[model samples]
Target: MIGILGFVAVFAGGRWLGWAARWVWLLAWGWLLVLLLAHAPYMPPELGAFVGGEFRGWFVLGVLAALALAYRTGLRRLQGRVAPVVAEARPGAFSAVELDRYARHILLREIGGPGQKRLKAAKVLVVGAGGLGSPALLYLAASGVGVIGVIDGDAVEGSNLQRQIIHTDARIGMPKVFSADVAMKALNPFIEVRPYHRQLEEGFAAELVAEYDLVLDGTDNFDTRYLVNRVCAAAGKPLISAAITQWEGQISLYDPTHGGPCFECVFPVRPAPGMVPTCAEAGVAAPLPGVIGAMMAMEAVKHLTGAGQGLRGRLMIHDALYAETRVIGVKRRAGCAACGGG
Candidate 1:
């Protein structure tokens, strides 16, 4: 009874003093060792009686305590190797897994924890899931945008495999938006992905654009571009629009509501049919869309997190063949039909 009391006192005292767990455990072990030695056969009979335990009983207790400590240590090591569960964190809060995943972004001076949190709370809409949209969507997902919406009517074709990195060969027959959804979710499971497996039209374009904070237009046709511009201008939403051809690509942030020109302000007249050839007609280079698409994604991140200077009121032209890039100044036209210079 005295031996047990000594052990309990040692442990309790160590804990009460806020000692390290290892030190507290060591002190408890020391007490047990002292008790064992007192009860040993070689020890004096009076000492053994005072300790109140047989030598063999104390020895068994020490062995059991060591076993328990070893078992606990091993269990802790196993738990350390296992991946943590990614629970659905509360709104505006981050999970442990998400924090580790975006540790790099959080470490950046421009995009610290507050900016990362903004990214996780933002919702962005990509108007196309084609060549330009592919890289933009992927980077947005990897950047931890909270909600991403992709819309496209076409199915993935074998030709898209060359530059559209998001879609796989197996998904050739899948709708572009669905394919984009799969890739984005596979990249980051924390964000929400909405796939509109149909073309954007007058019936739902306005309603759709209204649901998001920002819009990205990567469509190839003039009609869709004008329609997107019109809808975004009317809704006062910032639009990041980009286009790519054989070896050249251009991108701009058109937000007349925020001092930048709308798409129609820059290009007031659409070209006649066959004047500006489509990708199928002109055959775009494989990496052109990737370069411009990544720029679009970068601009989106900057816009959402307020990280750096965006392309608002500026047009960025990239010539991949010559490795040249230039930013030209542009302004909203007062007579423009879309935004009417706000």
Candidate 2:
């Protein structure tokens, strides 16, 4: 490089002047800088060596800049690998079995590990372990809700087999709550199943509703449904209620505390006697409860996990005969008696 610079400088001095001379001078200086950086040694060597003078400064600066850039690149690579480990090590995280069991849920961006944690921390009370409650209870348990409480006094019978899939022929005559408990436990041993083994009457309703974060009403009678709605409204808990008669079924999530209507707001006055018939009276289709009960369970899971939008303020109606469905918006009644006229 020095030999080349010498030749250019000689030519500039001989034939070139002014601008041409300046260009040659610039080229010479650039070549010298390249040699100092690329060929010079930055490490300590014999004192006053050839590469030790001012050129050492240039070599040292170049080495320092290279090291800084390499350090930054390495740090980014290390962080990329450490982030997943840190997230996996979060406090109170899931076990290997839990991760495996809920792999599909975790894979969903809307309902991943954090959503599953919310579900596990949730406490849900299902009123009535009959028709609608059967599938609802099974699904809630299978979804790994932390605590599930079921209240019912009715016993499983042969007639319930048509729509209530949670009970078996062998479990007939067993109290509905206990039967639900057995089924739920068998589905997921990680969850706790509390069987009330009694009716959800006036005296017990409030206390039971207060114990849970959410309530699901699947009772067969309008009186029980009204009672459960009033109790849930008083306790400031969300309620998922579903009912089916004949070939039609309807489900909704009623929560006046949030932005939705309470059950009483939608049905201010229960249908007069002989107006709204019971499932037994009207003969509900076998798959009607299963369909509605699963929908109730779906709404419950959404509410607990904060995944998708729930059925809050929306009633979902299904007609099996026509194979059609529709959703209707419902609003909270400002003067609703059940919701304290709020």
Best by TM-score: 1
Model 1 lDDT per residue over 1-342, tens place = 898788788778988898898898888888888987897668899998988979898888889988998999999999999998753423587888899999999999999999999998899999899999999999999999999999999999999999999999999999999999889888898999999989999999999999999999999999999999999999999999999888999999999988999999999999999998889999999988999999999999999999989999999999999999999999989889999874
What residue pairs are clashing in model 2?
none
lDDT of 2 by residue, 263-306 (tens): 99999987889988988888988888888999998999999888
Q: Report the CA-based lDDT of candidate 1 relative to the real structure.
A: 0.92
lDDT of each: 0.92, 0.83
Clash total of candidate 2: 0
Q: Return the lDDT, model 2, position 134.
A: 89
Worst 10 residues of 1 by lDDT: 84-93
Model 2 TM-score is: 0.72
**Cα distance off (Å), candidate 1, residue 269:** 0.6
TM-score of each: 0.74, 0.72
Question: Once model 2 is optimally superposed onto the true structure by TM-score, how far is the C-alpha of residue 326 displaced, in angstroms?
Answer: 0.5
